[model samples]
Target chain A: MKILVCLGNVPDTTTKIRFDGEMKNLATEGVQWVINPWDELALTRALEIKEGSGGKIEKVSVVNVGKADAEPTIRKALAIGADDAYRIDADPSDAYFIAAQIAEVVKNNNFEIIFAGKESSDFNGSAVGSMLAEFLDIPSVSAVSAFDFPDGKVVLKRDIDGGKETIGIDTPFVTIVQKGISINPRIPAMRGIMMARTKPINVSQPVAVDTLVEYETFELPEAKAECKMVDPENTDALVDLLHNEAKVI
Target chain B: MDFELTEEQLMMKQAARDFAERELLPDVIERDAEARFPVRQVKMLAELGFFGISVDPQYGGSGMDALSYVLALEEIAKIDSATAVILAVHNSLVAYGIETYGNEDQKQKFLPELASGNKIGAFLLSEPEAGSDATSQKTTAEDKGDYYLLNGTKNWITSADNAGIYLVIAQTDPDKKHKGINAFIVDRHSEGISLGPHEEKMGMRSSDTHSVMFTDVKVPKENRIGEDGFGFKFAMKLLDGGRIGIAAQAIGIAGGAFDRAVQYSKERKAFGTEIANHQAVAFKLADMAVKLENGRNLVYKCATLKDQKKDFSTLSAMAKQYCADSAMEITTEAVQIHGGYGYVKEYHVERLMREAKVTQIYEGTSEIQKIVISRSLLKD
Candidate 1:
């Protein structure tokens, strides 16, 4: 079985985010890019599934819909044990466009399974996996927190409103994985990094798709107010502040 | 002239950092307090190919450069010096010594297991009387044609109980003194070999340190690292490389302490504002950062020199001395920044301070390093 993982790059969670002068784009200066955390979990789970398959799963490939600048992030996935990578040379304008690019590869490759993060941390669009499934005309499972492969079928567990729900699907499926699928994402060892340098990363031209969304402006979240310390001795005062000034009891 | 780490090196550093934070940091304080060896974590590191960071790929190693090894070591040491020292000894001292000096047969026999960490390795050079002056002869290896009868006691040996193989330095000829010393690869499970109870330490408590005794244990002739008289030179050469590892460890410890102090300064309030806003606390952070940068530069320079196979003894000694001193001073200041909380174990700085002290004392003491540096300069 051949598996494909869709990788996305985002600023590290701890990076100090800033907006450009026009407030329409992220300030990239000094920003450290990482494999989107959710996508990393997805890639990790795919590798884990391959390992557990006992020779049934033959290959794991990662694809990214971005420019050459994103190759490092793609290489990171390769270092984490992906067999190879596909770079779709295009600006990742929107989920639909990105999904279309992936679908083009899937049509040619005939991959049995495709995995993607439930949402990219940058845009939080939560749209690509399902859209890719729709474009490819295959089953798509979202918010997959756990999975297993038994007798070549996909058994996935996902979180519902109050609990989890399990579903079994046939081959040729798309899964948008989240946390809890894998205990932790594997860090690429030094050996892996060395090998990744020589690993095949096939770059291909993007299959053009009409984008339906456009960014208007970017805004930073409002800064939080300084904390107000409450005196333990004045219970009434604390209660009054909570009820009136803070307006919470 | 390029100072930036290569992409591969950065990835290796990130991998080590991630592993250290996730696997080693969780129970580190508790482990230190309980003096428990992090066996599971060590195995994890081995699985990640850390045991053979600089070993050749054919020898089951990652085949990385020395700078990469230093980067990884620094990241690991930043979180837990105990675990870092274990890795350092295995990679820098034991496996490196064997790969550099051992014959092809010895390399084939030991490098694979050592690199894979199936058999952990330790360097046994220091003794009760042979700490600073490593040439003092007490351990003896009686040449017996087919094998040698080894008898000695090694003190303050790292990973003593856990190591499966030991690179033991012993005297083959009592009359030759330092020239008489021979390096031997002795299996820890050899007959007549015994271990003393673990030593309770001030810092790096989780790292197992013990006394190893060899009472007439027979070591195969093939296990001798080099020629009979080559032991002293072998030990010295390996120690020069070992200094780079220790220096990296020192930088890591100092970096860790500085990071914590910076975080604390930001969160701590004094005079109705964050302590970081105050000049006194801010200047301390500045000083710590400058020292850390200098120490890191020295460490990497030594590592690069070693990787290039140049004569780096003086540089290694200088790097080790400066970095270790920086670690001690920085950690002490970190505790001071934390105030009373730093004095206690809950805050973690006190433990870092304790762990930093040994770096100044072990491998080669700061005083010994100075001697090496001065001697080199004078000779020039």
Candidate 2:
């Protein structure tokens, strides 16, 4: 059995975001790219499963819907213990577009289980995993935290309304994993990093997919104003200010 | 020519950053306060193959280039200088020395354990009498045909309490003086070995530092590195590489402090705006930044020279000298920028500043480095 994790190439969390001249796209001048955090966790869980499978699980591959600039991020997945990698050479347009693109390649492969992070860290669009499932006409379980494969039987602990609900699922399904899937994402060892150099990232031309959403213009969030600390004896002034400035009193 | 890190090097840098931020940063203050060794973190580093970052894979090492080691060491030092020094002594001094000079039996016996982190390694050269003047050796390793009976007291040894293997330098024949020096790989658990209590240090307190005492310790002939009288030259060569690690560590310490200061300045309000808006603080930041960059470039050049199998001894001395001095300066200014907050332990700049002091004094003093560079210059 093979597992496929959907990888996303996103900027490092510490990057100071800046927009391009058009105000519709991020400036890529000094961005350090990395694998999306949640996606990395998903990959880690998959690798752990493969390591413990004892020949039951053959390979854990990764597929990324990104452009050439995302190669390093994709290779990071390979270094993190993904058996093989594929990059659909296209700018990740949107959640639906990315889902549709990934489905096309996955349909041709022998991937029994597919995993995707609930959302990419760059754009918190909690839609890709389900969209991919719909695109492939397969069932998917969302909000999964724990996954176990015992004696060829798949089990999952999914987050419910107030607690976790244990679930038993079969193969040929998509799993949208959230936190608690793994404690920490695996850091690539020196051996893995060395081997990653020759591990090929099989790049293929992306099939035509329609974008559902387009940004008109990008704007920075408003800078928060300093809070005015009110003295204990100034309740009346505070009330007056609240009534006039906040207009919520 | 170019300043681009390879894929492996970038991964190493990122892994080091993650490990430092996740494992070392949280309890670093508490560790510093308690003067505790980072036992758990050291194990994690060993598991990550950092202990053998530059050793050959055949000997169970990571077979990485010098740049990768520096990138990782810099990150580690940025978070915990104590832990970084432990790694420095192991990789650059002990493991590197053994791999470069050891025979097949020594490599097969010692390298695997050292690389695996199962057995920690320490370099014992500095005695109570000899500090900067390494030629003066009072310890004796009396030749006894099959083995040498060692008797010495090595002071200021990092990881002395935790190390399982010792790279001991001692005088084999007093008649030959410095030329009679020999290096041996002595098992630290030997019957005659003892250690002094851990030192109460001003900075880098988390690493276990103790003076090692050896009384009639037996080391077989196979454990000696190279031919007789090769010990001094071996120690000198290994010190060159060790300087590279320390230089990176110094830069990292400075960088760590500088980072905290920059963040604090931007948030710290003075008259009506952030302290960063003040020209005095801003100029200090500029100077610190330039020094850090210059030091980093010099260190990287040395690492690159080493990777290319070129002679890096003189430049490494310069790197160690410049980086250690600037680290002391930058850390002091970082604390100054943090004002009252920096004086405390939780703010971390205080700890970084304190930790930066030893970089100038250890491995080779700044004055010793100047002597090396001057000699190379005169010769050139």
Candidate 3:
């Protein structure tokens, strides 16, 4: 079985975001790029599953729909033990566009399993995985928190309303993973980083696809209120402020 | 000259930062308080190939450039100074010395194990009577035809008990003064070797520092590094590279403190405003940022020069000297910025302040660095 994971290139989570003068596009200057945190976790889990498969899983690969600037992020995934990677040479314009480009790669290669994060940390669209599955006419499991392939049987557990649900599925499917997919994203090992420089990243031009969504502008969230500290000796003053100003009482 | 780090270097830096923040930061304070060695963290670093960042892949090393080594060491130092020193000593001093100067046989025998971190390595040069002077002959390796009988007492040795291999400097022919010194690679478990109890240190307490004693230990003829009487020169040459690693570590310590100072100033309030608004505290933060940046550039320049195979000795001394002083100043100011909180251990600035003091004293003292720099300038 061959596994393919879809990665989303995003800004480092600590980056201070800014919009251009028109507020329609992000200011690209001085922005450090990284793999979306969720996608990285999915890739980690995929590598873990492959490592434990005892040669049952043949290879694990990654695909990203991005421009040339995304190559470094793709190489990082390869460095984290992805057998190979595919870079669709196009801007990730929208969810459908990304899904369409990935669908082409899926159709060309016979992949037994596909993994995508529940949502990209950048746009948080949460649309790509199910859309890609729909494009390929395959079943997709969403919100997968725990996954295991034991003795050739696929087992998945997801958190429901105050409970957990387990499901068993077959291959040729997609899983939209959330947290608990893996504990932490793996830091690329030195040997892996050295070898990643030689790993082949197949670059293919994206097929034509129509734009499905557009944005006009962006707005920054309001600044947070300053924390007010009350003296430890004055509980009555704290209660008075809570009742009069905060109105929590 | 391009000042930017390559994309690959940035990746290595990020990888190190991520690993240190996740694995080392949480328990660093606890480990320091208890003066416990970070054995688990060291094992994990070896698995990640951090222990041999600059060695060749053929020698079971990471095959990375000096800049990568600097970046990673700096990141690790920011979280745990003791662990970072262990890596600095092992890579820049022990493994790098063997790879650079040892014969093919020595390299084949030791590089794979030391660079892979399967066997820890220690450099033994400072005896009870010799430190910055470095030439006093207290330890002797009596030449015995086919082998040498070594007897020495080395003080303040890092990893003295835990190391599996030792690079020991001893006087082979006292008639020649410093020229008579020779370096040997010896098995730590060889007959007649013992260690004193760990030193109770004020800073970097998490690393094990002990006095090592060798009595009539037999070392094969092949274990000697370089030609006879090359030990003093070999040690000096290797200390040049070692200084670069220590400089980077010093920058890490200062940068770490600078970061905390900035954050603390912004969050801590005084007179109904963030302490950062007050000129007294704000100036300290500003000075810290400047010093950290200055030290960082010097360290990076030294790393780049070393990478390019240029003569980096003078600059290495300058870098080490400047960074150590800067780290001491920065950590002290960080404690000032934290006010009462900095006096305690939990805020980490106190620990950082203590850790920063050793950077000024170890490998080569700030005074020794000045001497080296002045001598290079006065060469006529």
**lDDT assessment of candidate 1:** 0.92
lDDT string for model 3 (B208-251, tens) is: 89999999999999999999999999999999999999999988
Among these predictions, the greatest TM-score belongs to: 1
TM-score of 2: 0.97
Against the native complex, each candidate's DockQ, computed on alpha carbons, is: 0.83, 0.72, 0.73
The C-alpha TM-scores of every prediction are: 0.98, 0.97, 0.97
Regions of model 2 farther than 4 Å from truth: A210-214, A236-249
lDDT of 3 at B367: 98
lDDT for residue B338 in candidate 2, whole number 0-100: 92
**What is the per-residue lDDT of model 1 for residues A1-249, given as tens digits with 9 covering 90 to 100?**
899999998899899889888998889899888998988988888898899898899999999989999888888899999999998999889999999999999989999899999898888999999999999999998889998997767899999999999998888889888879888889997789999979898999987677689889988998997788878998998999889988988
Order of candidate numbers by lDDT, starting with the best: 2, 1, 3
| Cα lDDT of model 2 by residue, A73-117, tens digit | 888898878988998998998998899988987898868899999
- For model 2, the local distance difference test gives 0.92
In the range B92-199, model 1's lDDT, one tens digit per residue, is: 999999999999999999999999989899989988888889989599999999999998899999999999999999999989889999999989899999989999
Q: For model 2 chain B, give the 10-residue run with minimal summed lDDT.
A: B44-53
Which candidate should be chosen as best, given DockQ against the real structure? 1
In candidate 2, which residue pairs clash?
A: none
Sort order, DockQ high to low: 1, 3, 2
* Model 3, runs deviating above 4 Å: A226-249
lDDT of 2 by residue, B1-380 (tens): 89998877888899999999999999999999999999898898888898888889999998999999999999989989899999999999999999988998999999999998988999999999998888898889999999999998999999998999999999999899789999999998999999999999999999989999999999998889999999989999999999999999999999999999999999999998899999999999999999999999999999999999999999999999999999999999999999999998889999999999999999999999999999999994
